[model samples]
Target: MYCYFDGQFMPISEVSISPMDHGFLYGVGFFETFRTYEGYIIDKELHEERMNRALKDVRISLDYSFDEVERWCRRLNEEEGGRDGYFRWNVYAGEEGIGMAADRYDHPHHLLLRKPLQRTERGTSKRGFILEHRRNTPESSMRHKSFNFLNNVKARQEVTSLATEEGILLNADGFVTEGVTSNIFWVKDCVVYTPSRETGLLEGTLRHRLLQLARQHYEVEVGCYEPSDLLNADEVWVTNAVQELVPLHEIDHVSFLGKEGPVYSDLHEQYTEYVKERVSEQC
Candidate 1:
């Protein structure tokens, strides 16, 4: 497959980087994962804005412009037959001297990965996730989508062993925050609720859109919530750019009838139409 590095497009096999890259050595990098629909990149602007915010938060300088990245992404989508596939954008400090000093010369790298869409269905449609409440400290880059993901990986592995789709993280005070790879949402008495941005959750693009849509149908509130709120929720769901929205039928051992619920069906239908409209713009 063809990939983008620095400013050039080349075969993925020919891509190379230094062994002292900060991303590999100290995990000091920011990245975003998005998918394409037809020839258009989904939520293109929002993803770029978020990546910019992440870069600012981590003090990583992005050497390329957003338009340049967008053009390259669109080209990859069309050339690699990526009608439906994932794309990864990475920016990190380049290899420098061996010490862990914060001072170093940094050169950002960009990679465009193309592959067939992966449709993974785990657990029942009506079943939700059983999260082991563990929160990485604020200093650990939990709020940024950086390359340091060993903590998330370890938690996800534990949840997978227990046969769950995703894991939920809670802050030190025991308030539900977010999932390892997605954002969490729930419906109660026809009102939708999610954790506030102050909870250190990565701002998900799809999560932002769904909240706007939900506001039209019901009251949407962002606040701190405990795990008990999830157990009591009449309906639960998770959202990501690729997954869209999937109903959560259970949390931990608690069973919830989310998939067959009226709220879930209605939102899912609306989300499908939203996608169709965006993808049709490319044609």
Candidate 2:
């Protein structure tokens, strides 16, 4: 496999970082995972903008432009047989450091990794497990895609079933936030609801796009919600860059009406069409 490390393209085996790197030492790094359809990246500009904002927030000094990053992604995708796959862009403090300080670093390291995407049925449904882990406080939340993923990792470990799709996490105050890997959403009485950004959930790219697409068809509400809200929902779904949207058959013991509910079917169909249009424009 080939990856982009720093400014060069090389075999993945050749890429390495210092043991003292602050990202590894203090979790001072952020990453973005995106999907490419036949080498066409979806929402590249939005992903770039989000990453830039994350870098600035953490004081990571990386000067690469989005155009340059996209070019590298295209090249790597072409080299990897031009199939649908996942791309992860990781930026971290490169300087050797031991403390929580960011002022010591002058430049950051950039790593781009790629892997072929596993095919899944578009109508696939998932069963969720309500995890005991609570998301970080709003003030301490790394809402961006950061390397500090121990919370998510721990939550995922609680899911013992292979058939289970994801673990739903709540905030410290017992309000539903998101899944370990995706943003959570539900439809109740024809209204779409998701946890607000104040819940300390990462405002995912696909989540944002879906909200925009949904608002044209239904009333979209974002606020603090409890598990009972999802348990009684007519339809439940999760969204991310790769999964796009997955319907939920049940959450813990609560069974939904069906996997492909009416609203979900409509939104999923529209999202699929939207993806096709975006990919065609890139082509």
Candidate 3:
């Protein structure tokens, strides 16, 4: 695989970062991950909007624009025979010594990583289980998809140790927060439910777009919810850019509609068409 570091493209194995880099020293970095479709990046604006807000929160400045990102994507994909690929756009505060600097970061470092796209087919299902670790509060006002991922990493370890595909995390107040790496959603009595950002979740781009699509046909609710509310849902699913939307067969052996649920089927179809439409536009 090839990764663009700073200003050059090279093999991922050859790329390196200084130990004193603030991103590695004090976790002062943020990133976004998405997949390209026929060389076109979907939801680029949403991803950048989120990344910019996170960078601003920590006074870390990034100068990369969408045009630059697209060019990088095109080049990186061409490296793999022009195939669509998964990409990680990471920017961090350049070397700033050991201590936390009070001034804003002017010399930022960046890396554009490319990997094979991996996602399950629509209608496939995965199971979820609640994790013993409570969800950690955001370091700032909102959760930034940053390098500070120890909490999620540990939860992910537990999920693997427990042999579950999706691990659900709860706030200290016992409200359903979100999946370790994805936003959570459920359907009940034809109304769609998901935890609000107040629960300290990294509101995903797909979650936001799904809400818009669902609102056109079903009532939508966003708030702090309990596991019981989820276990009792008519349908359950999790969303991320990589996975798009995945049906939950069951959580804790309590089965819902899973992939066969009417809501999941309808919304999944809509989402599939949405992506195809974007690909068509690119063509």
How many angstroms is residue 275 displaced in model 3 relative to the true structure, after the best TM-score fit? 1.5
Sort by TM-score, top down from the best: 3, 2, 1
Residue 91 displacement (Å), model 3: 0.7
> What ranges in model 1 sit over 4 Å off?
65-67, 78-82, 100-106, 120-126, 140-142, 161-164
Per-residue lDDT tens digits for candidate 3, residues 169-233, read: 99999999999889999999999999999998898989888998888888999998988999999
Ranking by lDDT: 3, 2, 1
Query: Which candidate tops TM-score?
Result: 3
Model 1, total clashes = 4
In terms of lDDT, model 1 sits at: 0.73
lDDT of 2 by residue, 144-241 (tens): 77888888888888887534577899989899999988998899999999999988898899998999999999999999998888898999989898
Q: Name the top lDDT candidate.
A: 3
Residue by residue across 138-244, what tens digits does model 1's lDDT show? Answer: 55354677787776786677664422366777877788887777888988888888998777777799998888778888888899998898788888887788777
Q: Could you give me the TM-score of model 2 versus the true structure?
A: 0.94
**Which scores better on TM-score, 1 or 3?**
3
